[model samples]
Target: MSEIDRNQGLARQIAKNIQDSIMQGRLSAAQRLPSEVELAERFSVSQPTVREAMKILAAKKLIQSKRGPKGGVFVSPPSLDIAAQTLHETTNWLVSLGAVGLADIVGARRSLGRLSIAAACEHAEREDHKRIEAALLELDHTEISDEDFCRLEVEFHQAVAAACPNSLLRLVMVMVNEALIPAANMISFPFRQRDKVVAMQRQVFSAILVRDAAEAISAFDTLIDYQSGIYDIALEQRTLGSRLR
Candidate 1:
């Protein structure tokens, strides 16, 4: 192998060893890793190779570097936000590339939405209720722009997802939002449809607030159906327009 390739292989091996240590509980969160020189000596590699390994770990969010007197590379705690952001970006890319279609996104959202509504109905706290209410109030603004309206709609659903106690479900919900919401927003929302959409959302909120899982799920399904109908109409119109040209 070339010198550069050999060094890269060593760097990956070192990074894997550190990842295993972290996963196996040998290294706890916030525990400072050994200095680069110490790691280079222990692993029998150059300091640059060890630095490459550190970069890999940092990119994966497995480690972080601090500056100053108390500064060093430290194990990073598991972060839901980082994980969710990563998933969101990947999902958006798939959607943009047409590797994932609107129907696929809608189906996934339906499955996940049912679970989220059920969990939120059972576990929603006072604070979660407050968030949903705040989003609802903003959505109810009479003269809201379509962009703001769409954004608040996503925020409202996110608030509902937050009410669910399962962290994994919440993370997946963010991915679903990234995949579906922007695509739906590309289709214009008529002013007449806005009232119906908000009304359906209100039904969902009321059902969840009362801890009525069945009702909440039903309302959510209805909203999904309406949105799917809108998407279908838009697709048909585009097809007809293409044929006319």
Candidate 2:
């Protein structure tokens, strides 16, 4: 076997290696890692390299540090819920700035939505299926208000994106979902059509559950088309205002 290189960027390498171990659970949560000197010796690198690696891990939230003799680097765990919330809040800020609008939101949604649909079709497990179905259940309950229902719709999409097992896609959805919250809320869901809407949602979940990619995409298109009426209302308001002035 070849010896570890010390003259190179060993610190980054060490950081990534430890990060993988932490993410993979090879290092349990709150467990202290090896000392920098020990790792430097093991990797045949300088102590500074090991220290740099630890800093990288800290930046990524993969590890936390402490002081004194008892203190050391500790592993951090993955959290999808927290990740999703970050995505949502950041995306919302982008929208509020006019950095993106409804049309852009719709386009991005369609693309990401298709990707999730395809993945969900191929990889949806029992838990994923339950999550998709649960959204519909909450929508069905009479206590859900219009604003809350719209938020839930975005949450449903974001949740499905999370199940795609792709972190980047989930992050993108987080921003997109937050940015679209206003437009999402403006989409009028006629109370009489609630059942139909819920049924369409079920169909999307069903397609994913069965691994039917085409069906999933088609169902999403159908659902989105119904929701697009919200945009039409906006156009109508703009036109009426122009005539009045």
Candidate 3:
């Protein structure tokens, strides 16, 4: 490989090493990484190479630099929002590049959503149930535009996922929601159709409230199947439009 390629590969390797350390809990969140000079010495690499590796880590938001004299790279603290955004952007990129498709996203959401809903049914307290109900009520408002309604739809799902006892499962739900946003935006649900969607959500909520896992999963499956049909129509429309162009 060329020198530049070699440097790029080295930087990636260094970044992976740090990422593994973080994942293995050897590098705690918010902990300062060794200085560039120290890292270069330890890795037997040039300071510039170490800086390049640090840049890779920073771009991934794995490590951030501080300002002032005490400035240094530190592991990024755990952030659900940040993680969700990263997953959203990465998923979008893959979809745009045709590396992943709507069906793959739909399948993932269907599987993960069922798990989250089941867990929520088992673990959600009355207050958690209230939050889900509130979001659903907000979604039922007739005056909201399609855009506003779509936003509420996502929020309602997120609220349900929040009731899950497992944080990791909740994060997966967030990622799935983010991945599905593009598909959701492609189909414009009429006001009447939105009402039907709200009814489906209500069914899911009702099942969860009663701790009926089978009913909840079945309702969720029906909801996903309904949405997936919309996605299929949207994809077909896009294909036809491209052919016409």
1-245 per-residue lDDT for model 2 (tens digits): 23345533677788878878777778898888888778888888888768777877776667888889889777755666556665666677777677867677778878878887787777778888888788777877667887777777776776677677777776766766655755545534542266667778888888887788999899998877766665667666767879999
lDDT of 2 at 192: 27
Best by TM-score: 1
Runs in model 1 deviating more than 4 A are 1-5, 187-192
As a TM-score, model 1 comes out at 0.89
| Of 1 and 2, the candidate ranking higher by TM-score | 1
Cα lDDT, all candidates: 0.90, 0.73, 0.84
Pairing residues by index, what is the TM-score of model 3? 0.80
By TM-score, highest first, what's the ranking? 1, 3, 2
What 10-residue stretch in candidate 1 is worst by lDDT? Answer: 183-192
Better of 1 and 2 by lDDT: 1
Q: Tens-digit lDDT track for model 3 on 1-245?
A: 99888888887888889999999999999999999889888888888888899998888888988999988889999988788788878777777778877778778888888999999889999899989999998999889988788788888889899998887787778877756754455453531377778999999999999999999999999988887787777767778989999
Per-residue CA lDDT of candidate 1, range 1-245, in tens? Answer: 99999999999999999999999999998999999999999999999999999999999889998999999999998888988888888888887888988788779989999999999999999999999999999999879998889898999999999988889999999877755787666764652388888899999999999999999999999999888888888888878989999
lDDT at position 97, candidate 3: 79
Error of 2 at 147 (Å): 2.5
| Ranked candidates, highest lDDT first | 1, 3, 2
